[model samples]
Target: MALSVLAEENILLNQQLATKEEAIRLAGQILVDNRYVEADYIEKMLEREAMTSTFMGNLVAIPHGTDDAKKDVKESGISIIQVPDGVDFGDGNIVKLIIGIAGKGGGHLDILSNIAITVSDIENVENIVAATSAKSILSFFERVN
Candidate 1:
């Protein structure tokens, strides 16, 4: 399966955000504006983030949610955003890469795991962060697969 089924290359972009809140807001807005999810969905994800930091370290934040708003997706989707200045994810470290995942009805674990593996690779992660366009990031998946 292609990640493109869930994420659109056009939706991914480089962000110049100054704070963690702004990064999350921008990511959430991307989903809403593209009809990938409802507006409240972002808030709920942020609430989840408050309960526990989603910062997995190495300047990465994976914010995810399993809700009714995402039940119709058919497959999970991931949107990648690069914040140039980095944002504070309440983890004492700045976050430069934001990965947002929204599952379908259920059974999105596989997709999530795959993404985790991909990003966990130092080389792969570096390539993605250094990518100049969404096309470059999308191509990384091809090599991984």
Candidate 2:
């Protein structure tokens, strides 16, 4: 089975987004491009963002759709975009990594859990941001996450 977190095609490194919305939009695009979810999934994510910021501590944000968005998912998948420069996530929060997820059959919880645990360590997040290549980041996830 394909791993839901940071799949080879889903991981984007050293990207820059002008705003949280652009980052979220790009994340949704990654999901759709990978055939993990439908295009409408982007709308669902935007709506969810309007309700609350997904920004987690350690400069991470896990943007996901509301429960209703589940139906739009064709497969459980995740996208990781590294913006080392960081984007403002409101309330003076700037997120360096944006993890956008589209989960089917409740598999997203596992994906999210792994990320939450991994990023809980400040050094881990820093190392990931500084990773020179996508392979290195994936290797790190395989080893520690």
Best by the TM-score measure: 2
Q: How would you encode candidate 1's per-residue C-alpha lDDT over 11-95 as one tens digit per residue?
A: 4666777776667777766666666667787786777676777788777888765354465343456667977567888747788
| Model 2 vs truth, CA RMSD | 1.7
Worst 10 residues of 2 by lDDT: 1-10
What lDDT does the true structure give each of the candidates? 0.69, 0.87
Q: How close is candidate 2 to the true structure, as a TM-score?
A: 0.95
Candidate 1, which ten residues in sequence have the lowest lDDT sum? 66-75
Clashes of each: 0, 0
lDDT per residue, candidate 2, 1-145, as tens digits? 2243567788898898999899999999999999999999999999999998898889999999988998899988888899989999999899998889887887888887788888899899999889888888788888785
Clashing pairs in 1: none
Best by lDDT: 2
